[model samples]
Target: MNEGLKVFLAVADERSFTRAASKLHMTQPAVSQHIRSLELDLGAHLIERNNRMIRLTRAGEIVDRHARQIVQTEEQMRRLVHDLASTIFGALHIGASYSIGEYILPVMLADFSKKHPGVDPHIEIGNTHSIASMVASRTLDVGLVEGSYSPNEVETEVLGADELILVARNGHPLVRDSFVTIAEAEKECWIVREEGSGTREFSDRFLEDHHISPERTMTFSSTQAIKEAVRSGLGISVLSALTLQMELELGVLQQIRLEGLPITRQLFIVTQPSAFQPKVVSAFSDFAKEHFSDLTQTRTPVHRTSIDET
Candidate 1:
């Protein structure tokens, strides 16, 4: 990628000269010079300033699209060269949906880094739809997402299956029984993930299956947020078992397995089809798939000791 184009991308993504400069480790004035030079060479204005806000102009949008491709191509070329030397190096753009990113990915990344220490990871955490789109767009080398997605030019392999269940704050009266019924579960306010989330999709389907129309509901965008809400006694929510390990162990939350409900969804590894799979990408994908069970395993419930008992 051209130097000016690189600077422009940083600016475009950051949407501020000051932030872009900080990201690029360059001065704001120099960053502006690079953008100005690029615009002058192309004979068009690429950005606009209105009320101290930076917005990409029409030409800028076109440039941004093509510039990303240029950068992607350059990265591939670099990977190809490094492959000839049999070295696994360079930054890896890894994307993951919220639940996996929050609860599962750090361990995977840490394990991967132990072998390929040279591989620098850049993570993008978002919902399933967004992660799949990023993988299709080549902005992400690989993505781990739950639920279903069909982005053009991207392929997915099921890494593993995950179980979802209803949960409530520890000792909440609504779940005195180890098993809960949909009728009993439906009366309380339901907390849910955002529209595009895999968890949200499952929650919606679960409702339809049970013929539920909760009287009240709340929405949250992240797994942590939903967990916090449930912990704070805002409402009950359905969530993956993988996310409940620490909370369950600590006695902060307890599972409320619904009768006849053992809800499950496939975990996926999304990647674009390419002739040359970079060593880093292949290594991480294989590692994740092989160890998928480790991430999905549910901790066995044990007796909890209270502060008084301790």
Candidate 2:
């Protein structure tokens, strides 16, 4: 496939031997050699070269269509062979958003690896939008995200429910309060996840629905950083309750509830409906459903405690 389409597509699209050679990472003479060989085999003048420019002749146009179809068919065939070999031993490439990757997938993956030692897992972490795009482009076998997506090209399965909770450093002035109204919480400094993050997206919607806006906000890329910043009393943030479990248990942070904001998001597993997923991916997907389905079943209440309780 590479030899067949390499020179033809490059020359046809670029219309210049010099440019096509550069695109194909081959010398100009080498590109000309391949084209000449193709012409000899086909017995046709496929291209007209003139003054540093090239155009496809009638025969060239006819062959280009067949060349493209042949290339596509070859790709499909390769995928099929790879999938077959992967049933016994294959790699699964999974893309996940920040929260799911950091707080959830490690445990799920650990269990899956123990069960299926023959499968190799490659994980990529990004924001929801980035992961979704990667799955759509076939760069990833599947994606797990913590928000709703409306992509027509992909199929989404709801895996579980995750809730966002407002948390602050222990012993903060608000920790002793039984309830913090949205308006009152908005007056405090806030540390938030970066834009495009699933937690941040939910936080923004939570704030909007509650009719409250933070007076001061700081953004951090990782949940660990945000947790550390909030632990030191830098600010408060709305984050996944799962992300703050250790802190909550250690009395480093306290969850504060606000009125009128649901603060919950549905976790989803997204994949291209038309794409073929390898056997390893299917195994992992089944493993995920078996072990992690409980995480999505019901929303848990935020636990609260004072610094003195520690």
Candidate 3:
């Protein structure tokens, strides 16, 4: 019945058996059979299949709503059982923005994996706004993001601080100076992240505040790409301090001190405001906070000039 309900929901959502089959990795005939079996068991027509698309009947509408609830309840029950048994074995879905996912999360995940070897972790990386949206929709169990999100849709906890610093090639003309003023900074070419990036949002707001509309020569979606471009002297960019560690040490890039720069923002752990959180999700969140807490305490204090919203 659970399987049938799943098939029904997929079909209902897709409005096409073929598409649902593709989504479920099943044959079209198999999907039809599952829907048929479900209708037979219920003794009512659950769906109306037209030549073009499918629509749910009145009974199907009620069934669909109840079916979703049943699936959610089943997941909750499984989580509760695992928690009561003191077992840490389950699949966890996590989403993260590029900054945290690329630079910060690997070590934390490695440590968590070692302690909870039974857990299976799946991570999806996207921009902060997109990742937060996924968490709000419950598509991901939890999300780590570097930007500001709506408080109404999801609950957020400050994970740590990220310092946005301007970086350029070591030999760039700007590097000769101790600090570049807003006027001097505006004369340089810039390589920035694409839209929807938390880092870009903060950088743009900072640039706007300083009234410096620098020429944007290149835009990249990933932090690594932006860093590589900067290294090649394509242009300067503002990036997270955590991301520039290896590049700085390797002399590939150097931070250009701007007179009023180095914006600081809080990284966040976002989750849906639901009453029930799976044990695995809850455990991972707590572990991440505890883990980063120690790392934060040991780090040297960075004097913050201004706080960016993201």
Candidate 4:
């Protein structure tokens, strides 16, 4: 019945069933049937027809004013529904690489939750590569990672910068010289994150660029495990400065300043294109970016070399 009203309104506006049919993508007979149904429901003759032209009867003129209002109401209702879905409340599934998830996101999420208590945020931690794949598949609504993402498949914005540096157990021989040369650093054994991790990606690029290869490499699936292994004197590892804040303060692990060190990489916020983005995702993403912008301005810079060196 409502569809019949809409068709009749179209027909009335167009002043021809054939034109209305063309506009509505329906056959002329279908348009006439809709008008007939509308007329039967109203118990009035809405249109008077000649051989090739039609005019609205008095009843239709009355109905036409009301029909326009009804159509406008429907449009407003649709917009309200869309607005509620986008901004009000829903579960937000977020994916992040281990470095960002463990070291960066907890505080951000806590702050966000305080402001939007109705929104439930659940996080999945993985390597950057895996997290990017999840975003592409629509499994994760948003992603924060420290590695590169394909601009073609996923939309990315720079979140911030993460500074990478080398770490070893306190009092390791490498730190005695204040700075180790690339060739000298390569001779040491290394404990590192797995191949797909963002840290590993940076480390691999850094190594290849400088032509440094460790004598042996031990892989760990997690940042915590790598930190522990490095603390126990298994070997030195390259890690985000953000992750080593507590350890550096506690003196459990010491940074080994390498010549030309502190590789800075851009952290990224990733999502599907705007067409695919949900309301909650856009809200949170904007909130986070604004919050981090203020934070970056006020926050003291992390020393590129050892804390004591600064």
lDDT (Cα atoms) of all candidates against the true structure: 0.86, 0.77, 0.84, 0.82
TM-score of each: 0.89, 0.70, 0.78, 0.69
**Predicted model with the maximum lDDT:** 1
For 134-219, candidate 1 gives per-residue lDDT tens digits of 89889999999999987456889999988777788987887664555557777888999999999999989988877888879999
Worst 10 contiguous positions by lDDT, candidate 3: 301-310
Alpha-carbon runs more than 4 Å astray in model 4? 1-86, 294-310
What TM-score quantifies how close candidate 2 is to the native fold?
0.70
1-310: candidate 3 lDDT, tens digit per residue:
3999999999999999999999999999999999999999999999997888789999999999899778756665787788888787777778999988998789989999998998888799999999999888776778999889998999999988768888899888887545666777777788888899999899989888888888555789999998888888788999988777788777778878775577878989998797767778888999988876786676534334433321
For residues 229-297, write the lDDT of model 4, one tens digit per residue: 998888999998878878988888877877547888888899967553556678789987876677567
- Cα-based lDDT at residue 90, candidate 2: 54
- Mind sharing the TM-score for model 4? 0.69
> Cα RMSD for candidate 4?
16.4
Best by TM-score: 1
Residue-by-residue lDDT tens digits, candidate 2, 9-55: 88898888888899878998999899989999899999997886778
Q: Which regions of candidate 1 are displaced past 4 Å?
A: 301-310
Question: Of models 1 and 2, which has the larger TM-score?
Answer: 1
**Cand. 1 Cα-lDDT:** 0.86
Query: Which ten residues in a row are the worst by lDDT in model 2?
Result: 301-310
Total backbone clashes of model 2?
A: 2
The CA lDDT at 107 in model 3 is 91
Give model 1's TM-score versus the native structure. 0.89
lDDT of 2: 0.77
